[model samples]
Target: MAVTLTDVAARAGVSPATVSRVLNGNYPVADATRRRVEKAVRDLDYVVNAHARALLHATSGLVGVILNDIADPFFGAIARGIQATAAEMRRLVVLCSSSADSSSEFAYIEVLRRQRAEVVILVGAAPEDAAYRREMAGHVRGLRAQGARLVLCGRPAPNPHTAAASVSFDDLGGARALASHVVSLGHSAVAYVAGPEGRTTGTQRRLVFAKALSECGVSLDPALVVAGDFSRQSGVDAVRRLLASGASFTAVCCANDLMALGAMAALREAGLRVPEDVSVTGVDDVPSAQDVTPGLTTVRLPLEEAGRRSLALAFSGHDFGSPVVLPTELVVRSSVVAPSAASARRKLA
Candidate 1:
């Protein structure tokens, strides 16, 4: 016998009306409750009636795109690519911003499911939580069962079995390359401005930076490592804390270009000159990185290309043999230079 609405409600521990509300998108539901219902739908392999399925199919030309922050150039570039690809296919993209909140992300997923999106693309760093991962996996499976594709862009695949495709940046290699470049500049002591903790992107970059430092025989100084939320303000605050700590360092490395801009501003306020008093590096060479005075030396992630490829993968409807890993390049610019003799001597002091 086919799974019924009653069976799904029983499996999710909710009333049938609640499951109906979640599936029909006619009423509001709590995030946790929505996830439970989605999970139950997937677990029971529930299928809507023929008439309901026909109605959903009739409304199909929508693709959903979720991002941490569309205001950030990093995500904006990807969104552009997604939009460009979508335009060619005569499909409309429903862009959703989660603002780095896991609950909001899940809620958006449910909304897209209710809309019966043809494809859903999730971009940016995902929260490192077991329960969230499990719920997301269920959502992916549920969406696929309903003829929608789920793609992860710049995020780790939550479940190998459920994700239709995954596209990720080479964050580890990029961070290692960046650190190596800074170390080669005769700067032994370097400070780090890391992205938010518990995020895979930030954690991977930080770990690789530390590993690179170790390989260069440089000591990992906890005092020099500061955490930020990949925001300009967070970068400013982190740099201020680093300065107040009085840790002597010749260079600072930021997880993203926005933070690098903030770090540069803070350094100037502290009466320091870029590359003269202190060198700085950043990841993700956003447009501003080049326009900023003394252009930022950083790692360049192919944001737009990654976005385009993700959409292509979604459109192709082919099973990806493996997750696509995009390459990152080390972009050397005026922001980085050999330490001044005075700064070098200060390192020895």
Candidate 2:
């Protein structure tokens, strides 16, 4: 017979609600009461089999991962790391793509919760929305009560007080480093290709990128800032708009390598040369960043390591109430250089 919550409560000499509180760690329970509940759980040998046994190398249940888009290389690299770790533990992984939609994200999360997945990792940054926050708060509470884990990858935790584990790259610092690099190369007039508006990741990077340039005595002209959805096509469209509007800039800073590559293509279409007619730089030093003609100057994010660490945090009894900010590095390549003589002449004109 399966040991129920009532049975565990009876053995602990407490009410079912008390046992729930202790197990969920949502409310303040006396240490003694918590110990009694834990002891009862051990005596029943019910909860341990679902979790502790897995720590002892028993094949665990399903681990779910919901990504913005599995097709994007950014998410693919992180999922690769997660798959590697899950494979070692002989666990089955369930992967889903949410198409970067909140409705889809919540639906998949609920489905995983019903499956009693060992852990569910959300691997995208949803746009900031009040309704979504309220829904996420409810999901966090529900996941806690189910004795399952919720991990946020590349997204902010609903609240710092919650037990949700999160790991993200240092996007602000990377933006700062990349901006400083562009400023140092003597390019004052710059265009910025940003990601979707209201996305926490894009907002954080865009704000810092502009501020860092200002601190270096360069004003990031608001007229030159364009929004993209972190896609090559969006980057192409943004550049075409700038060209049509006759925006004068010596360089363009893209939000990611894919966008930068597209920007390079658009510039070539306009009869301009990279680092000669204009310099270009991007964040996320993915593998293809260096494969282009001039090679992209980008920031290297530890994406795979983030996946591995997030999974480790799921099983380890560590307090993950706050986010873990991994470091980022600036990689210089042939794509960026001092403004060329012809570009300087045009800027002055």
Candidate 3:
């Protein structure tokens, strides 16, 4: 005979509700109670085997993951974390992309629901569309009404009465630190290669960078700032535009690693050696950062931790609006150096 909740409760000398909370990883259950319930489960040789149970219970042993852009290495690391954890728990993950499209995101959510995904994880920055928020919240609430879980990775919208949880890293603080470091290096005439201006992450990083520059008594020249979507081509364009303006910039800070890599390429094409002619730095210590020529100095965000916490929140059924801030750090490498006299001469002549 298969083990039941009743058998486990009787062995643990607790109510079925207590066992349920423990098994479901609900935060309200005491640690002692959780341990006792776990012991009882072990004594009874209990196994979840969600696959078999799901077949009978009409629940899918699957989790749905939606990302803004999986092409980026940062999101790829996060996706690996989620997949690893899910596989360990004997569950499958269905990956999809919203492509930063609110309509497409809504459609994907509906499809996940129809496919009976017990939980869904939204990765990367939340869409800026007000309609996206309303529709996503409604979908989550509707899912809860029918009993399901949702987890928002990265920046989630502010909603209190929704069945959702979130995991994110500290964007403003990281940007501030990066900008401050550049300022401390005595680079007053610095250029910024920002991500899409419309997106929250891009805007937040740019705002913090500007604020840090102001705090350091450095003026932000509008001509020195270039905004583009987070892409290698955009990075190339931004750097090319900055070069075209003939601005005397000593350093370049890119919003992401790919852009930074591209910026380095552009500098080379313009007959400038990285850190020799103009210093360059990027966010996210992606694999390429270390492998790239001269090694791109960058900030490292804890992608795996973000993934693990996101899954934990979803499984525990926590409130989604509560954001978790992860730590970030600056990684020094061969890409950055003091301003060069020749670089200044080029700007003047």
* Candidate number with greatest lDDT: 1
Each candidate structure's count of clashing pairs: 0, 0, 2
lDDT of 2 by residue, 215-260 (tens): 8889888999999988898899999999889889999999887888
Candidate 2 lDDT for residue 248: 90
True-structure lDDT of candidate 3: 0.78
What TM-score should be assigned to candidate 2? 0.82
- Candidate 1: residue 252 lDDT (0-100): 92
lDDT of 3 by residue, 165-186 (tens): 7677777777777777878876
Regions more than 4 Å wrong, model 3: 1-58, 158-162, 347-349
TM-score leaderboard ranking: 1, 2, 3
Tell me the whole-model lDDT of each prediction, alpha carbons only: 0.87, 0.83, 0.78
Output the worst ten-in-a-row residue range by lDDT, candidate 3.
Answer: 50-59
- C-alpha positional error of residue 259 in candidate 2 after TM-score superposition, expressed in Å: 1.0
Where does model 2 exceed 4 Å of error?
Answer: 1-60, 319-322
Please report how far candidate 1 places residue 53 from its true position, in Å: 5.4
